[model samples]
Target: MVSELCFSDLPAEAGQGWPRGGEMVGITLEVQALQSYSLDPHYAKGLHAWFLSQVEQTHPRLSAYLHDGESEKPFTLSRLMGPFREQGGRQVIPPNTPFQWSITGLNPEVVDWLWGWSQRLPAWLELRGSPLQIRGWKVLFPPRTYSQLLEQAPSSGSCSLSFVSPTSFRHRGHHLPLPVPKNLFHSYLRRWNDFSGLPIEVDLFLDWVDREVTIQRYRLESVKTTAGRQGSVTGFIGCIQLAASPRMPELLRQQVQALLQFAPYCGTGHKTTFGLGQTRLGWLAAERVSTPRASQEEQIAERIQELSTLFLSQRQRQGGSRAEKTAWLWATILARRESGESLEVIAKDLEMPYETVKTYAKLARRATKNYQSV
Candidate 1:
C-alpha cells in the first residue's frame, strides 16, 4: 500500500446513486491544464466497461496512450458507440488535497528542475505491484488490474503527493534545466496558478492565451500533505468529478475538441492520456465551403453531411438530434417536391394546416441558401 495518498477518502460512496456493483474499473484522467469539468449522469447509467479520453494539445494524440512508464496502447476496456462512463472501484485517494499547491524555499535548482520538463506530473502506475505492467498494442487482460490499481493508489489519510506548480506535470523527466525557459509552460502553468488560488506576478502566459479575455483569480483551501513536503497548501483546482459529472461520450467529445485546439502546445508528461486511450482530433469547419455551391438534391445531402460532421465531430457539440435533423431534412425535400401533394393535402398528411405546410416548405427552401455553396 502506498504510504502517501493524493486524495481524500471518497465521501462514503456506499450508496451514491451511481454503481459500484461487483468490482468496477476506472481510469482517472488528471488534466493538468483543465480549467473545468463535469459529466452527464444520463450517460453514466449506460456504461459497460471502458472509458476513453482525448489528449489536449499534444501531437498525433499519442501522448494519451503513453503512460508514465510505458508505450502507447489501448487499455482492456469495452468500446461503446454513444455514452461512455465507467465505475471507479474501491481505492484510497489522499484526503483534503487541493488540486493545486505552491512551493517556495526550493533549492533554486529544484525550481529549475521542475520547469520546462514534459514529465513533471508526479504520477506512476502499477498494473500488478510492478511499476511497468501496462499493455501494448494487443488486447489487454487485466481482471486484476483494478485490484492492482487499488493496491498502488495512495491512502486517503496518507501523505498526499502533489506538485507545487500547476505546470509541475510539464516538468517531468529532467531534474533541472541548464537554463530554465521562462514562460515556456505558460499554458500549463496558468492552470495550476488558478487552481492554487495563489498569486501570480508573471507578465507572460500561454501562447494565444488572451489575458484580457481571461480572468485572474486564486483562493486558498486546506488540503492533504506529504512527508516529501510541508503541510497542506492553499491552492486551486479546475475540475473535480466529485463536484459535478456528466456522460463519458459527451465529456470525451469536449476533451477531444480542446485537445485538437491545444495539442500543439501541451507538453507531454503523463502518458496514455491518463492511461485510458485514443487521441480524438476535433476538426474545424470554416464558415464558407468553396464560396457556396449549386443547390442540387445531392448537393443538399453533401452540405448536410459537412455541417453535421462539424457538429458531431465534437461530442458535446449538438445541432438538433440526429433523428430531428433527418426528419427536418426529409420534410424539406418533400416540400420542395410540392407538386406531388396539394398544400392542403400535404398539411393534412404531415398533421399541420395547409398554410402552415406551405409556410414550412417555403421557409425550408429559403434556409437552403445558408446550407449550400453559391
Candidate 2:
C-alpha cells in the first residue's frame, strides 16, 4: 500500500521556512523508503555520518567543531520512526511508507546552518547504498534561545521527561542504564552550561538538585543495543515524573524547569549524536503502558556480546583494555558476517581495513571451532 506523502512547501506554521534569528531548534523530516529494503540494525551510524558530510559540504568550520569538539555536541538525532517488519533477522521497511526522523540543534550556529541547508536539502538521504527519499520537513520544536528558555519556563509544577530512544550515561568507565535524578539533570545541565552562555555553578546547583529534586513516578526498562561503530550500550527507554521540593527557592525552581524543557533539545545522555537519546518534554503514554520485544538492533547486540564473552574466555591474556577490544572487534566481524553482510561492508562500517577484518573473521571462526570441538 502506498502511503500518503507530503511534497508541498514548508507549512505556514514553520514560520518563514527557517529559524528565526538562529536560535535552538528541532526539526522532523518526513521521509520514505524509495524501494523495499532491509535496513541495517546499526543504520544510525550511517545517518550520523551522512549528516556530518552534509554539514562539511557547506560550513566546513562548523562541521569540524561538531565532529571534533570536546564539548557537548550541538545537535541530536532521532532514529527513524515508522513502521517496520522483521524478516530474516532484519528490519524491512516497505516502499513509500512515511517515516519521521528528527534532528535538533542546541546552539545558534548549528541552528543557522540547519536553516540554510534545509533550503536545498537533497532529494534522498543516502544510507550506505539504500536511499530514503526526503518528502517534507517541518520544525518540530519551536526555536528559542537559552535565556529565552529560562525566562519563559513555567513558574511552578512537576516536569515529566520521556526518553523515546535508548538513553544511557557514562558513569566512571561504564554505561549507567538507569536515569538517577542527579545524572539525568547533569546531562541536561552540561548542555545548558556549554551553549546557554549562562553558566550555573555545577556543584552548587546539582547539590541543591540532589537534596530537593525527587522522582515522583517512573516506569523504565533497560535494553542492550549496538550503536555507532564499536561497543554495545545498555540503556533505558521510558518516562519519569519529577518534582522539586516546595521549600526550594523560586529562582532555583525556575532553573529546574528550564533545564527540563531543554531535555528534548539537548537529549538526555551520551551518544545523542547517533540517535541513542531521543527525549521529549511530556510523559509518553506508550512508553509507560506497553511492553516491547527486543529490537533487531538489541538482538544483534546480544549476539555480539555473547560471542565476545566466549572469545574473551579463550584468550590467554584476558583482562586488559586491549584484550577486551580485540574480543569485541572479532565478535562484531563474525556476527555481522553470519547475518549475511559482506566483508567489505563490515569493514567500512567498522572503519577497519578490509584485510584486517578478513583476518579477524578467520581468527574468530577458528576460535569458535576450537571451542565447539571441546
TM-score of each: 0.18, 0.91
If candidate 2 were superposed on the true structure by all CA atoms, what would the RMSD be?
3.7
Best by TM-score: 2
- Count clashing residue pairs per candidate: 44, 0
Off by over 4 Å in 1: 1-186, 205-365, 369-374
Tell how far residue 70 is off in model 1, in angstroms: 37
- Report the C-alpha lDDT of model 1 over 1-374, residue by residue, as the tens digit: 11211333332221122222212122221212112122211111112101211122332233343223142122222111111123221121222212211111011121222221112232322221212111111101111222232234322211111111111122432112111122222432442233223323345322222221221222212211110100111111121111011222333223222322221122212221221111111111222101111123223334334433433333343544564454343443343243233565444434556676666566555545544644
- The number of the candidate with the highest lDDT is 2
The local distance difference test score of each candidate is: 0.25, 0.83
The TM-score measured for candidate 1 stands at 0.18
Every candidate's CA RMSD: 23.9, 3.7
